[model samples]
Target: MRNVVYMAVLLIVANEIYQKPDMGLGVFMLVFTLSRQLQDITSKLLIGAAQFESDINYMKIFFDLKKLERENIDDTAELIENGDIKFENVNFSYPNSEKLVIKDLNLTIKSGEKIAIVGKNGSGKSTFVNLICGMYEPDSGVVKINDINIHNNLTAVRRSISVVFQDFGHYEATIRENITYMINVGMQVLKNYFN
Candidate 1:
C-alpha cells in the first residue's frame, strides 16, 4: 500500500514536470524509476516473508509431533524395571541415499551388560547408536527393549540407556547453565563449587 502511494506520487510529479517543461524533469524521471524499483523490491520481500512463515509453520507442526512422541516414549520407559536392548534383522537407508547403511543387522544386549561397538568410519556405527537412541527407525525388522518392541515402547528403551557421542558439542553458555543442561540436574551442585 505504501509502495503504491509512493509510485502514484512519483508519477504525478513526473507528469507535472513534463507538462511544465521544467529542468527538474530529469530528477522526476529518476525518482519515478527509483520508486518503481523500490516497489519491486518490497514485493519480493513480501513474497519471501510469506515463504518463511510457511516454513516456520511446517517446523512447528513437526516439533509438536516430536514432542508428543517423546512424551509417549517417556511414559513407556517408566514401566520398565530392567534394561535390555535388541535389534532384529534391521535395515535402513538414509533419505535420498541410493545405498543401505545397515542391512539385516541383528544384535542383543542383556540388562547391565557392557558392550563395545567397533566399526570403521561410515560403517554404520553411529547409525546403529542413532537407531537405539530412537532418533531413527529401522526401515525393516524390529528393535526391542527388555523383550518389548522399541517401536511400541520407545520411552522405556531411551530411559534405559545413556550415550555420550564422540561428536558432542560444547555449549557456549555460562558454566552453570552448561553443566545443568548436560546433567539435567539442579543448580545446587554448582553453588558449592562456585562458593
Candidate 2:
C-alpha cells in the first residue's frame, strides 16, 4: 500500500515536470533525491517503531512482575541438601506460547556431576536452566533438587546452584573481585568453599 502511494507520487511528479519543461533537470533531480531520503527515513522510522514496541512489551512484563504479590517463604522451608537435580516428565512452554519448548523431558544430574548442555538456538537449553533455577515452573511434572521440588523452596535451590552464562558481564577488576561481585559472603567463606 505504501509502495503504491510512493509510485503514484513519483508519477505525479514526473507528469508535473513534463508539463512544465521550465522546471529543468535540476528540479527533477531534487524531487527524486528528496523522495529517496523520505523513503530511507520512513524505513528507519518503521524499524525504530518496531523496536520501541518490543521494548514497551518487555517493560510491561517487568512492571507487572514487580507489582505481583508473592507469598512469604516460610523460614522452615527445606534447603537443598545435596543438589541432585532431576527433571521427571517435564513439559514447558513460555507464557502465551502454544509450542512446548521442553517436552516430556527426563534427566538427572547427581551432586558434583559435570555436564555440558550444547544445542542450537531456540533448542530449550536456557529454558532447561531456567526451570532448574526456579525462574520458571514446568507446565507438568517436576524439577527436583535432592528429591525436593525446586518450587517448594526456590531460594534454597538458587543459593546452591551457580551458573555462568555465555554472555556474562565483564568487570574492570581482578578475577576474584568479578567472581564475588554480587556475592555477599566473606572471603574466608569463599576460600573454604573453593578448597
Candidate 3:
C-alpha cells in the first residue's frame, strides 16, 4: 500500500514539474504530507501486528491451560463417609526444591476427632494439609483414610475432605445468596423461585 502511495505521489510531482515548474512548491508540499501520513500508517501497522502477536500467544496459553485441566478421570463409586486420616513416614518437597518441607512426619487422627496443626510461618503446616487433602503425593510414604491408601482412591479421599480458604467466594453476590449458598436451593420451592 505504501509503495502504491509513493508511486502515485511521484507521478503527481513529475506531472507538475513537466507541465508547470511554478507548481513545484505545491507538489513538494503534497509529497511531504503524503510521506508523513505514510510513516504514521506504517507505525500503526507495526504496532497493530505486535499487539496481534501478543494476543495470539496469550490465546495459545489459554487453550493449553484448558487442555491441561480437562481431566476425564471418573470419581470412585465408593463413598468415603468416615473422617479417619493418617500420615505415616511422609516426606515431601516442592517441585524443583531440595529442602525437605516435611520429613519423617507421622501422625494419626481418629474418625470424628478434631485436631489443630500449630507452627509458625514456613513450617510445613500447609504441606501437611495438602498431603491430607490428596493434593500432593508423598515421596516415599503413605497417607491413609480408614486404612485405605489415599493415593489409591484420591477422588474419594478428596470427596471426604474440605478446605475453606480466607477468600473462599465471590464478593459481588448478594448477602442473602451468600448466606444461603451452602444449600444452593434448600427446597423445590426455593429452587423454582431461583429458576
Q: Each model's TM-score?
A: 0.52, 0.52, 0.53
RMSD of each: 10.5, 10.1, 10.9
Which candidate's TM-score is highest?
A: 3
lDDT of 3 by residue, 1-195 (tens): 867777787777777788898776777777878787877899899998987876676457544643544333334436688766888898999999999999988888998897888899889888888888888998878999988888877766655677765444432357777657534422433333223
Question: Compared to the true structure, candidate 1 yields what TM-score?
Answer: 0.52
For 1-195, candidate 2 gives per-residue lDDT tens digits of 667867887788889989998988898778778888898899999998987776676457545654655544554444465768899999999989999999999999989889999899999999898899988899999999878888887757755667767766534468788678536433444343333
- Model 1 C-alpha lDDT per residue in residues 94-143, reported as the tens digit of each score: 99996999999888889878888898999999999989877789899887
Per-residue error (Å), model 2, residue 99: 0.8
Stretches of candidate 1 exceeding 4 Å from the true structure: 1-81, 173-177, 184-195
Clashing pairs in 2: none
Q: Say which candidate scores most in lDDT.
A: 2
- Candidate 1 structure lDDT: 0.73
- Candidate 2 lands at a TM-score of 0.52
